[model samples]
Target: MITAKNPVHAALFLVLAFFSAGGIWMLLHAEFLAIALVMVYVGAVMVLFLFVVMMLDINLERIRQGFWSYLPIGALIGILMLAEMVVVLGSRYFGLEHVPQPAEFPAGYSNTKELGRLLYTDYVYPFELASIVLLVAMIAAVALTLRKRKSVKALDPAKQIAVKRDDRVRIVSMDAEKK
Candidate 1:
């Protein structure tokens, strides 16, 4: 029985289902679509879900507080979004009488290779821009959390390297005759 209490397990189940479906799609020769679904939804979206569930300290009471107030608006937005998606999908059936499928690539050509080539060649600028954006985001995240504390002692690598053994260690033998 699937329940809300075990969201991580439920998400894992969903991820497995998606991966299985993607494999089936690949077997059916829809490699592009299967790879997209697996990479975007399974890899990115599901991982994000797992990370959020694991990392965030969720306040159930705060979430519930505005539920009643937002119910109508949320429902209305959801219905509108669903209607839009239905219309957009249905238009493909009604408007397009017949769309020609591209000829299959040669047996030697790989789908993954073709996708990589396209991303690197045709979409190079966009790909580079996306990478830069991600780099900036990473830097921003590090900057946000990074801080220096006066109370904490920090190791200086140069100082440690420069120190002689005698500065840090000592060995002594005392004469027993003095006692």
Candidate 2:
């Protein structure tokens, strides 16, 4: 996975890495999270990514035009983020004095159950808000994609429903010929 050189290889490697992490989570007794991660990231996200890559007409040259100008700033930001993460993770910086230690784990403890308890009891409001936000984002994406083109004769249900029967079916008086 780490041997990826190009963007496509990197994406594939990332998907593989997520799957591996999910497997690790499963082994650690977080089956719910493990399955969720695999299903969401591997099944949905990776497939969506593949579709986007395959379908999109990407303008590489346009993107690369200002790459050199942006590189320094991007690299600086990345370095700062790495430093912040290191500080947060390092005991020497954010030590025992700053935060409480994790509770001792009982033998045969289920990580998934613990996570569920914490999620419902402690973080339910945040969880609900996150879901609502995601729903809104999905709706927004659908609205954005649904552009009404003047060229196409698209039917509006409201307009169709409002139409009178007389307007649709016109009765014509014609002389019947003897056959």
Candidate maximizing TM-score = 1
Global Cα lDDT for candidate 2: 0.80
Q: Across residues 93-160, which tens digit of lDDT does each residue of candidate 1 receive?
A: 74433432345456576667877999999999999999999999999999999999999999999999
Report residue 94 deviation for candidate 2 (angstroms).
Answer: 5.4
**Per-residue lDDT for 18-119 in model 2, tens only?**
989999876655679899999999999998887786677766577567878888898999899999887877757665454422355566777678788999
CA lDDT, every model vs. true structure: 0.80, 0.80
RMSD of each: 4.8, 4.9
Model 1, residue 93: distance off in Å is 9.9
Clashes per prediction?
0, 0
Instruction: Report the error of model 1 at residue 115, Å.
Output: 1.1
